[model samples]
Target: MVRALSFCAASPPAAGPHRIGAGRSSEVFAEGPDRVVKLYRQPFEPEAVVNELAASRLAHGFGLPVPEAFGIVGRAGRTGILFVRLDGAPMTVRYAYNPLGLLPALRRVARIQHAIHACPAPGLPSQHARLRHQIEGARVPEPLRRAALAALDRLPVGDRLCHGDVHPGNVIATGAGLHLIDWQKASAGDPAADVARSELMLRYGRLGPAWFSRLFPVRMARRLIAAWYVASYRAASGLPNEAIAAWRLPVAVSRLFGRPSDTDAELLAAIAALARQRPDSESASLFSGPGRSPGRGQPECCR
Candidate 1:
């Protein structure tokens, strides 16, 4: 069951901080000796920042390895978040430099994800509601969208905290330990749906524009990593394959709202087709053959 969280307002940080890093939506700046400020590039609702801060505090309270958030701050005409600074490279960069360590890295990733799901976080947005909104707003065929939404409505509602975007890039490996960041998308929901979302982002989500697809070696490495990652997660969580498989289509439909690259077009089409099929007959097969790994030979749904 979901637990209640305390939402405490935090004071804004001081101005003129040194920039440390930048992401698609926000810029990180060094605040004091222990904290950093994440200033958003565009205007966002205050409630979003409040929710993230609450989630961070909730996770930290559960003894999960997450950065501690101080609170929201407004600086330079943009809203920002002040939180503990983690000194480490993202898992993606680390794996890129040491491809051979992919298996071990995936093991750690799966353990951390399992840890996240082990904790209950109430008072956060419901992932089910969020996916429903995304499915309703996606620019896919009307029939596919409707089918996806219907599938989502039939799934069980869960209260576990899901790091909505649990990709390698969002995981930081420090000397102390691994830390999960980007709590902006964190929500309360079914753990299976959360796991399925990570699978989609790691395997099928585009890294950049269409031209990046030409990197065949990199793509193959990613596929290998994705397969191992999903396998590791399944083992660590001890959740049935069918539970995670059930979420694939709805998660894929929600991902369509991101405007994924053309490379994902065929995979998305396969996911839509599977979503329209009978749930019990072939949905599980979409991610695994009779004897193969969970994602090794599956269709785009597993990719």
Candidate 2:
């Protein structure tokens, strides 16, 4: 059964609130000293808001460090969620200045992700179902799409909580500790699948325009960060490389459904290449070897 929560009416118009952050689908506003409101853009789905609310409550009930979800609110003809604001810099911004902190930061992310998977998330949508939907809808070549669907079928189904999107940007480092935000994509499924999604985002997920990503230094830094993250997660989860790799195709397809950007071309090509290869092909070699890729001994970024 779907859990229901009431929506509170906003005191001030949505546009009047001081904006703190913005993402593809929503804009976060500082409602007060201890709370914030995330107002979705026009034409947003109410179902998504409901899912986030229930998922946030579930994570909090498990004693996770997620913010307390006060309730939903309507402001300026938009739906928003009221949450306790934890004032802290996103892990991404923190790492940008001190690249040397990359590995430990990723390790911390791994621990938090693992802890999320340890809790049961009943009443949440199924990750497999969501991925299957994405695979069916992805605008990839037909063969690759079908192959991804087949791969999804072969994977095991699980009830463990999966933070659909667990990237550094979504994690906040407060004085109390790290708090995982953005529960909109949370689901219940195989923990390996969730880890696989994170790996794809950290490694190949486009950060910005293709032109900016083409720079040698930027590309190298991203690769190093991604490689270290995968390594750290592998060590922490004790899950074999193959287990995570198996979910790559499906996860890649799902990523396509996100807001389109200039980097879509490269992402599509990568997905197509993986789809053509056999499940056990040498492509899995990407996850093997020290540091995952041939690079200088531990780049100063992840010191």
Candidate 3:
């Protein structure tokens, strides 16, 4: 615990601690101007919080846009971490009300993702290790699982900082710019795999009620936004689209185990499609030659 603060209610009772945001794993409550507490819901354990605290401090020390994690605190039988409160609405919430901002917000997040990769964080856990563990344990067919493992073994390992997860909901739109939250999944690895994970989440990760995302227009919009995000990242990093596509198969497989049921089918179909394509012998890339690529077709980054 680094400068830990007690969880008991503080002064200014008129505007006391209250819930500011809620997610599947945790609820955030504002403690004061400088700090907020992210309280994990039932069946919580200390390991994730411990990881978040370490990862957050490391990211902050590296001058990344991550919030400073203070330490862990217990309250009402739940575990929470105190963080330097950031003032902003999540990028997804902002876009929910202003659909027009969707493009710019995604583009900005792409740049943020690229910037994150530029800063190396070798002290963090291995992204490759996590992918291997998850893919081996995923519910996909054995052939697909073996293919994913082979694909994982083929991709180049890197030492760049990886957020591991970067859906729109994880980014906050602040006055300064977009800030990334949720550090439990932070790790160090290839930027391409990280970008693939971001693309997968943006394209299929659930944001709201399933009914809303199932709508035809909403589904199309999700595809466009995800494509735009990749285009932006490609422009900034000059990382070949082939590399990102190669990573998509394994990353999608790794994500299937614990995601919402709505995302599983799409991921499975995409994984199967990528696996069917005979990759280049030299590079083993599923993407090649002028075609926009299956399931990942979108606006050209070359423009």
TM-score of 1: 0.84
Give the per-residue lDDT digits (tens) of candidate 2, residues 91-129.
765566777886797888887787788788899999999
List TM-score per model, in order.
0.84, 0.87, 0.84
Worst 10 residues of 1 by lDDT: 1-10
Can you list the residue pairs that collide in candidate 1? none
**What TM-score does candidate 2 reach?**
0.87
The better-scoring model by TM-score among 2 and 3 is 2
Candidate 2: worst-modelled 10 consecutive residues by lDDT: 1-10
Candidate 2 Cα outliers beyond 4 Å, as residue runs: 1-15, 287-303
Cα lDDT listed for each candidate: 0.72, 0.75, 0.73
Cα displacement (Å) at residue 161, model 1 = 1.0
Candidate 3 clashing pairs, residues 3+ apart or interchain? none
User: Going through the candidates in order, what is the number of backbone clashes in each?
Assistant: 0, 2, 0
